[model samples]
Target: MSIYIDPAVALSLRGYEMPERLGFGTAMAPVMFRAVCQDGCWSNGELIPYEPLSVDPAAKVLHYAQSCFEGMKAYRTGEGIALFRPEKNAERMAYSAKRLCMPPVPESLFLDGVRTVAAYCANLVPGNSGESLYLRPFLIGTQADLTVSASTSYEFYVIASPSEAYHSGNMRLWVEREDARAAVGGTGDAKVGGNYAGSLLSIGRLKERGYDQSLWLNPADRSSVDELSGMNFFAVIDGALHTPALNGSILEGITRFSLIDLARNLGYKVVEGTIHIDELLGQVASGTCTEAFACGTAAIISPISVIGDDGGSYKLSQVPGPVAQHLRQALLDIQEGRVEDHFNWMLSVETVEV
Candidate 1:
């Protein structure tokens, strides 16, 4: 598919300046990639100056929350600017769009939107380890109507930000017992906006109690571990890596999947199964579960120092333990191009002339 480059995009890119402080997704790039779908027909993609979107007040996205997004990164690698497993992101976003009853952005179009934005903004991709050009590709329903149904029109956009690691410090998680982030047969597995919106209340409550994130339990039983609010949960127990099995309510994170492969390659016994929260806490208390961490695109791996529950706090023996440190460094080495991309994860993108 052909991508149209707006003339103003060059001006915006030229005029924009990077700030000294880049905190996660706070700093935005000057250009954006966009496309529209009307009645199942998608338009050609376009790269334009980043600006406020003009949407009707009665749009389905505003009222019905028919929106899904994906988070990925463009890294300044040894060879050039590279995207880490972008195809996986495209596939996931397609799955998310399908869950919302919206037209999935074709994989080619999704790749074009991300690659075009990353190629043009190659200079904006940060060179620091753990820092990169954070890409957010999203699809939203745009049909203007008050009735509740899927929108006939949709908008897909790719915006970027130069960001540092999402969380640099060890996290203290709250074992959420009162609320469920996603329903049993709901949009939990999909990266939709409503799933996150429903989780904010739990996060807010946890923050008030001096916690970093909410470790959600399976909605079906509320006993087995599901995942953290936005990231996948992992724990090192008895010298093996254990993560929650992908039940219907868990969002299968790309980083989580990669870690499983990398860990097994590094000779660690990796297990994916139902991890009950109580058993995990008991193991932690017994020193069998030495360390725990969360993984996602933004925060590659954040060590968990403590798990707070109503009963009491269960602390891990090591914060940023040997396993997490090794895995994080291993992943970063490949992402920053310090090591070979044996897994064929990084896809290099040539810089485009503005």
Candidate 2:
């Protein structure tokens, strides 16, 4: 499929200036990539000016909630603009789309959308450490009928934000037991809009209690650890790196996988298995679990200082454990091109002269 670059897109990029403060995915890039699908046939993609979308009131997304998205970043590495493991994002998005009965976006098309947006907005990517152009690719059901079924038509878009890292300091987590974000046989593993929508209320409730995030528990048994709203949970137990096993319900995080590989290379034992919440809290209290953290594309590696449950709270022995600090730095070094790309994970982009 051919991609059309609109001339107006260049003008918008030229006139745009990024703001100084970028807190997560708030700021929008001047241009965006768009494409549409109708009755299983996809239209040629286009680079267009970023604008508010117009949708019919009875769109399928509004009723059936068929939507999925991906979160990635474009970095200003010394080798020019580079994307980290974009193919993983593409594969994950396909998995997410399939879970919702939507057409899986072809890998080539997904790469094209992200590359087009990142290449045009290359100049706007922040140069500071832990800063980059945050890329968000999403697809929504657009069929203008109010039936409780998957839409026959869909709209895909790639929006961008120049932002700083999500969480830089230590994060205090609340052990969520009363409410579950995703269910046992539901869309828990998929990066769907509904999963996040379900988690917002829990996050809001935790914020009121002065907590930074919620460490969700497994939906089935409610005794094992699952993950956070948008990140995967991890901890250092007995000087080894430990994370909750992907039990058919945890969203597989890119950073979580990368850290697992990097930690092993750095001589740390990495374990992926079920972790009982009560046992973990007990270990934290006894100093066997030295540190705990969350990992994702958004919140790189936020060390957890405290974990509060219904009965009491357990504090980790180390806020930013030695393992967490070392692994975070190692991952960031490779991402920002400060260190060698030993894993060949970085994909260099050819700048499109607009």
Candidate 2 stretches greater than 4 Å from native: none
Q: What is candidate 2's lDDT per residue for 90-183, written digit by digit as tens?
A: 9999999999989888888899999999998989889988888899999999898876888999999999999888898899899888899889
**Regions of model 1 farther than 4 Å from truth:** none
Whole-structure CA lDDT of model 2: 0.91
Give the winner by TM-score: 1
Question: Backbone clash tally for model 1?
Answer: 0
For candidate 2, give the lDDT of residue 315. 86
Report how far residue 342 has shifted in candidate 2, in Å.
1.9
Model 1, residue 63: distance off in Å is 0.8
* Cα lDDT, model 2, residue 297: 89
Error of 1 at 256 (Å): 0.6
Report the Cα lDDT for candidate 1: 0.95
lDDT of each: 0.95, 0.91
